[model samples]
Target chain A: MTTGKGAATRLRIVEAAAAEIRERGANATTLDDVGRRSGTGKGQMFHYFPQGREELLLAVAVHEADRVFEGQQPYLDELTSRAAWEAWRDLIVEQYRDQGLYCPLGVLISDVGRYSPASQAVAAQLVRRWQECVRAGIEATQAAGEADPELDADRTAAAVIGAIQGGVTVLLSTGSTEHLEAGLNLCLDRLLL
Target chain B: MTTGKGAATRLRIVEAAAAEIRERGANATTLDDVGRRSGTGKGQMFHYFPQGREELLLAVAVHEADRVFEGQQPYLDELTSRAAWEAWRDLIVEQYRDQGLYCPLGVLISDVGRYSPASQAVAAQLVRRWQECVRAGIEATQAAGEADPELDADRTAAAVIGAIQGGVTVLLSTGSTEHLEAGLNLCLDRLLL
Candidate 1:
């Protein structure tokens, strides 16, 4: 839905801000840092985000929220069999491992989600969409006779999402993917059973 | 280990800072705000925390980290049976629900854990201790033959911890406990299976 030179510049600002926040943290990051990283002047930054830091932060929250699922795309969309689930599991492990101790979405939510309803909605929507994808995958697996057809898809999906979220939180703190692997593996085991 | 008037005043500062951060967030919380809330002066704040805000923040991080497991004490300590597990799960749900929208430990880790080794160590230790409790419970359940004996206790515990973390993360964002409930239920189901 985005177009035009202004849209492209806005996207650049958002991306640069997201990266800085990812590295330096939300509280520590300044608009000057974002402007420098994005190669935009104060005038241009204000042009896109007149409400200043809060508006820019909200945009970064939205951007980071989208990336949470977008990064897992194709694999998240493909769930025809037990093998596909396994592959997706591996992808997730690597994804979090590479991202390491800095989880952009988690940081954004913690920084702005509590104080702002709009930011909270972005996080809620992301979680909802993430759970929906997992539920869809479970249904596909059930239809393929690989999973229990009578299983509660919504609960299962919610559990899976929660496990991943928890895993990432631990990973950020401890620099370990063991929890993520365990959570995903256990969720899949339950699904298979 | 704390005693005397000086220790009490230090505790007061840390507690007030934590409460302010919990309500207003870390970035928005100033030392002046903490001093006012705790009825301490700049002299006392600096005397107690010579390195200033970062030192105070690290202390707050440690304080919050300790509280994470302390709140679930006795119950977390007594996860010896299926019944105890269920009780613990309920307690966890109620605890997070009561806390709501503001996870102090999670916020502290996000704010300081990534940049400082001391803060990261505090977070890592908390997660380790948390998983150990869960693993001990799983081991106990297995000993009673209530759970699959061959299940990987460490991994299972990690997954359960992650699920709880994930659930709380979502709950804070959405103001709902569904994900947390789902994560706990699903993990328990797998454990009992």
Candidate 2:
């Protein structure tokens, strides 16, 4: 299915909105700003997103969710070896370091009135997908006899996710990656022990 | 050595701004909005904070830092027993649950570009103070012979702070306290182990 030029323009608007939201924040970014950035007029933006800011925000939420997993990539997919875990750790650290404290996912969820059901669903789906990937990695490590076989994979996976989030929060607050490094080290050390 | 009414009004303005920032993110808030909420006219607001929004934001930043330590309170001060740790954990959980995912500290730090140099200094001071409290707790626990005697208190404190942050980030993203609980549990568990 070609999906048409109109669909492409709509996507461009959404992409631009997501970028703006990431750079600034959701509440700070306006539709006019999106239109200007995306090269669409005010009328064209409304034509594509009749529901207006709410619809556009939902789209941005989904886009941000997709990027979360996409950014994690092959490292999130494979964690059977120590080398793989180190690679994944490096990727996680680099992602936050490069972004330097802006958390798009956190920003999207912070606004109480801005979240529609669609946005909530996208956020939930993203978490579940991310958790599942971690779970799979834990299972792979267990199967490879690298991690404790008796350790509950689900719990460990949750802990890993929790640690990363905690570390990121600290990074966001202080503009430093030291806390993030500590969290990652603790999780990996626990696994090795 | 009595402070003038001007100083008192300035204090009130800062308090109101901090509350508003806590409820709605820094970017979503405006000087007019803050003045309205604080029951101050533009003239009065400017009279107190001549530099305008940036000065007010810096004031709010300092207020938030105080709140961070104040919220951690007697619990953060007392970590001599296992029971004390549990109480501290409960306090931490309730703090986040009641705050409801809006991290005032994170919000203030996120908009650093819009804040004055004093605001940045306040934030840095807050984190250092927080780390010191954690370090104190670690030292107390070690003195009680609860943790490894030879363990580096600073590093352990850093790890604990990191774990809590990583966990809180997950809680903010998922809207569940489970991750926060897990992170706290893992840290305490490892500390005892």
Candidate 3:
């Protein structure tokens, strides 16, 4: 269980670093800058993150990773029928559209995660968990007889996850959500056909 | 048309910058470092990329973008049959697997392209051209009566592209190609269905 004062300060530092990384990118952000923005001294920052910038970044990566599911919540968890699936699809498109091209976790990973095996594991775990949720939804649809039972839930789930990712990647570049919509539509349609 | 000497020198600069960015991430790479790595003086470096680091990165983004299609080779273009599509799919999985987690284009775009319209344009154009090739393949499949005539060629192609992007993104994080293979399989199956 997390305590009050110490936990709050750590949260503040992380939120500030995440914002700095978002605007300036992880590679460009500095501990001093984070201290300036968070109004925390280096001593206190170090107290919270002893390993320094890398440790703080790893925290941000996990925090941002949590948000990937949090942003699509309730809907991401609800999947009993085709209607539920479509609603979730719409929510995903709108979510990424609202977030625009900047992917916080993606920025963190590219900046720091790619180089560190531990950081990479944080990201890898996110992908695995996210795919599992999608896989569960597919299974739910199949159980409801709304989706084809013959479909491989794990593979379909992976493809669906990939489709959304692809769409998000394109959206980041082109500032358009069409591919996201197209991928979701095509994948969802595949279930029924 | 590019002259022999100038073009070679420019190519060297771009190659050096690209390697640095791949290893260090774009934000961490400097023009001076590129000059050092390429064994060129600052004067020569500026002669080729006077706009400095951003310009050099833009060139690298374009270079990496070209490689995306080039690596696929005649297979990407030869999508006249299911055999061709399958071959391209296998080639893609193998290529990305061999290339591993580091994506130079993704790095360049995230670091510099996200803020600059010109850099974003380079990425947008690459995705557009890449998707166009996929659309052509889908159209060819339909023409050959191998795929469902009711399939929306453009949408399907875009979705497939998104799927590949998603798979690649996961691969970059998790160092696994399962999602990529699943996406390709699911999308290709949809065409025949």
Candidates' DockQ values? 0.75, 0.47, 0.74
Per-residue lDDT over B1-193 for candidate 3, one digit per residue giving the tens place of the 0 to 100 score: 6689889989998899888877776777888899899989999988887888778888888887777788898999878788889999999999888875555447545777566777667777877888899999888888998888898899999888888988888777667788889988999988873
In model 1, what are the clashing residue pairs, if there are any?
Answer: A166-B166
lDDT (tens digit, per residue) of candidate 1 on A66-145: 77678887889887688899999998889888865655457546776565776677677777878889999999999889
Interface RMSD values, listed in order for every candidate: 1.3, 2.6, 1.4
Q: Which stretches of candidate 3 lie over 4 Å from their true place?
A: none
Which model, 2 or 3, shows the larger DockQ? 3
TM-score of chain A of 1: 0.90
TM-score of every candidate: 0.89, 0.86, 0.93
Candidate 3 residue lDDT tens string, A1-193:
5579999999999999999988877777999999999999999999999999888988997887777778888878877788888889988888788865556447545766665777667777877788899899889889888999999999999998889877887777677788899988988988963
Stretches of model 1 off by over 4 angstroms after superposition: A1-3, A32-52, B1-3, B41-43
What are the candidates' C-alpha RMSDs? Answer: 2.6, 3.1, 2.0
Among these predictions, the greatest TM-score belongs to 3
Tens digit per residue, CA lDDT, model 1, B68-102: 77888788887777888899899889988986555
Clashing pairs in 2: A165-B166, A166-B165, A166-B166, A166-B167, A167-B166
How many residue pairs clash per model?
A: 1, 5, 0
